[model samples]
Target chain A: MSAAPPSPAPRAAVDGETSRRRGLGWLLLVPGMLWLAVFFLFPTIQLFFTSLYDPSGSYEQGYTMTWHVMNYVDAVTDTWNLFVRSFAYAGIATVVCLALSYPLAYAIAFKAGRWKNFLLVLVIAPFFTSFLLRTLAWRTILSDQGPVTSFLQTIAVLPDDGRLLATPVAVIAGLVYNFMPFMTLPLYASLDKVDHRLIEAAGDLYSSPIAGFRRVTFPLSLPGVVSGTLLTFIPACGDYINAELLGTPKQYMVGNRIQSAFLTEHNYPLAASLSLILMAVVVVMVVLYIRRAGTEDLV
Target chain B: MTGSLASRERATAAVPPPPARRPAGRWLADHLVLLLGILVLVYMFVPIGYIFALSFNQPSGRGATAEFESFTWSNWGSVCEPEGLCESLKLSFAVSLTATVLATLLGTLMAFALVRHSFRGRSASNLLIFLPMATPEVVMGSSLLAMFVSLGFDGVLGFVTIVIAHVMFCLSFVVVTVKARLVGMDARLEQAAMDLYANEWQTFRLVTLPLAMPGIVAAALLSFTLSFDDFIVTNFTAGQSVTFPLYVYGAKLKDFPPQLFVVGSAMFLVSFAVVIAAELWRRRRSTWSR
Candidate 1:
């Protein structure tokens, strides 16, 4: 792939061409960037501004520029528990995904050769179906008379009266199942890149297979671990669907709180404040992860 | 070289004291983890299998007992009825198709800019493109709603609103996917074309686009799947319009229709077929390359 390196003279010319191309590039990017800035980013900034000023119970009400920063305080105090629950569920789900996906990723990346693509496709295939549909399926499978519960009863794991639906466990299970592919794919990508010869070299140096894995394979795959965890944890923290579908009121996450605030409760300022806070949490975590992983390691 | 010779000698010497190994037992011990891994895969697939089974099960009109009963095609029949699943499926396909195409064109341009150009605020521009994807969907939806209302638009909240939302989110994936491919590609190919007197557009069309086709196809397919499967943002933006997933969700809560499973199973089947085809195409490409 690196057979022919370009000459320096041509490289300089190429660099000039690339710069010229970049000018043209801006022309192409402007339309899309303008669209996002207008529709997405501009509104987000407006949301922050709107949150600071109370809405006069009408969409047409103009905001008072006087910063009612108290909206942030009010939102936090009101929905503190929901924020805690969101992070708690996402945190647990992240750990569970790691525990399950690591071995499966290892199996696909290192063990399976001929069937590797088949197995990877199998992992991804369920995702093609709507995520909501999959969650709804879990609702059925965990319902009172569902086969899963009946089987559990036959094995004496639960009493006949025990219900699995509308529980935190079901919500977490739905989350872990839905996001497992995100965790596995990055792990597989990293694990697949680990040179087999390095493992052999470790073995030749009198390292046991376990020791070799710990020293070489594990460290190299840390990038994948970090990326996978970030991908799963961040999204899961803000997820509302699983909690709303599979869980009772007690399982409401920050997302549910935000939804209800805006849609059900019709408190736009509170919802806007909550949205800003959630975005801040996500931005901080991403910055922290990027710093820890080093910017170059992420891609 | 010295360590290799020494290890060879050690292996020859250490084998003298060993009992002859039983190959089958060693094989079993070595493969136990992999077998267990397959078991875990089966466990992960069980819910999907249960859904598939229930979709075909006859409706007994009773709670859960119907799942254990004799099989029937009635649920599927109901899903296929003129007033039912077909309408949702048509809307889903149309919206997903429109979103994918618009996103691909705009996203590919942004990707080209990011890869092939240098500009002021480039890093921040890249981050801005990615922020929507990283932001929570509910937040995105609510903010978009606010934007529409604040702009004096009646929150169009139908096909147009849903398509715009889908494109807004899916474009980031396209940019990321295509930019990764662009970074890996050789700049010399297009440079060589330019040196041969091809104009910029000609060079891109003849040399760059073909090389970027695989990434473009993957991005398009991914965006299609995402747009098709989206619910949260679509639910917020889709006021009166009923996409398939939204329809299923509404039905599940209101009537608990047994045929919802049939619709879900059909979706699963369609997605499975597409994925399998993609896998096969990829494999064929690799073999042809070899």
Candidate 2:
């Protein structure tokens, strides 16, 4: 049932009801809000402050805020090449995911008919396994002695010494494989909402099928495209697991750098700076996209 | 059905030209989209098949062999009867279950608040809730680690820490999902119950809660899957305890254990069953509603 039709309820009655509801709502939200504020937001703010001050041995040397602005500079300029490479890999993976997922999503949304649900389930099934296991499985498949290598050799595609594992290509492939479902599901939702009659009408107007798709289907699916790309690209840019498991040192992304800085190098300031920069980049891109396409473009 | 019929009528009225006999090429072209879809599906699934096949292939008694000349259950048996593998699996399930329960409670409350009320700073809180969900897991993990260390919360990295981290991350998903369901729900039913002399708690229990159960269940299942499958965040937070993924990661570094595959396959099967069940339930509910 929809809302009750407008009745001239007394103003005092409505005010009392609304206020009571508001009070209840606040009560409901208190536990969650307090949990997040103390645990999540507070820690993140602490991280920002920690980044500004240099730690002396332990966390509590009564440290002063030095505002190591150079931490940001060092993260960007010192490891500038790595940062660029991370974006390059993430960008390529996003494009590849788009190229592959669009057709699959289109088919499931518009053409698969009875098989669409099964196909969608198939896309999600891989995620059932641990991500590490999937990455390791790739490692086995891509190893020099693995069947894939041998098959490539048989097909004359291998350059006798070319390796698949620990390469940028491998890293990108892993990223695409891992994140493709994120791209597909959103795209499918968008495509499914499109009115097929629009395409039929375009066809009736003497538009070619390709022209009809370009004019009708593609434009309607722009929201999905933008959302899917954002989902894949942002995570891909920040991914370290795949690169660490699949790629060589040269292929390390910003995520890998941050992980090492925090874990091994003990460089909290630098790590925080890098983390902030990565977040800033993502926020800016999202803001720009939202401005251009409207917030509804995101799911 | 009415929309489709009206559109079909409109099409027939507009295009009176006799249907041209479909050519062979036209038939092929019409089905090309489906064919490409199948190809994409194959690409997505083949690697999974390859992994399964490799898992079963017997280790030729020398080194790792890719050929699947023989299948053996030794790997599965070995993993099942170990000093710690089973323990790790038990810990994983326990931690995940605990996290799911906590997350569902907090997240559902947050969702209720977000959907049912208008309050100051509501928008900011909404954004804050969602931001953690979107943030990179690595950043969340390391930041939590930093936070824990800063607070002198030593040895807080075992089961408690892992569960806490999981709940923290999973809370947002639950909030988002439940809020969506709440947005679509008719609030008038609760109001009607209240009008019938039911208190707020009674109305929620009798009317709102039952209606929201499907969404709550879905949210719970999703949170469980997320917590169970999480590696990046747990890796940072789980101090001494080794969950299944952490175990697999450590095992991989030394020698990729075939047992890891068996454990992986077991997890995959369980999660797949749960997801399929959830999907079937959702479908049945929708059909019943229809």
How does the DockQ of candidate 2 come out?
0.39
Candidate RMSDs in Å, in order, are 4.9, 5.3
lDDT score at residue A236, model 2, on the 0-100 scale: 83
Q: What fraction of the reference structure's interface contacts does model 2 contain?
A: 0.48
Interface RMSD of each: 5.8, 5.7
DockQ of 1: 0.39
Model 1: per-residue Cα lDDT over A1-299, one tens digit each: 01111212223347677677557868989977887887788889988887887644544455565587888999899899999899899989999999888888888888898999889888887777678778877887888888778888888887878777788898898889889888988899899999999977865555545656777788889878987987798779888999988898999899998888777776788899999999889877876776777644343
Model 2 error, position B170 (Å)? 1.5
- The sequence of per-residue lDDT tens digits that candidate 2 reaches over residues A167-209 is 8888999999888887998899889989989987866654446
Q: Once superposed on the true structure, which residue ranges of model 2 sit more than 4 Å away at CA? A: A1-13, A55-64, A153-157, B1-30, B60-70, B187-203, B277-290
Candidate 1 Cα misplacement greater than 4 A, ranges: A1-19, A55-66, A151-160, A295-299, B1-32, B62-70, B82-84, B191-202
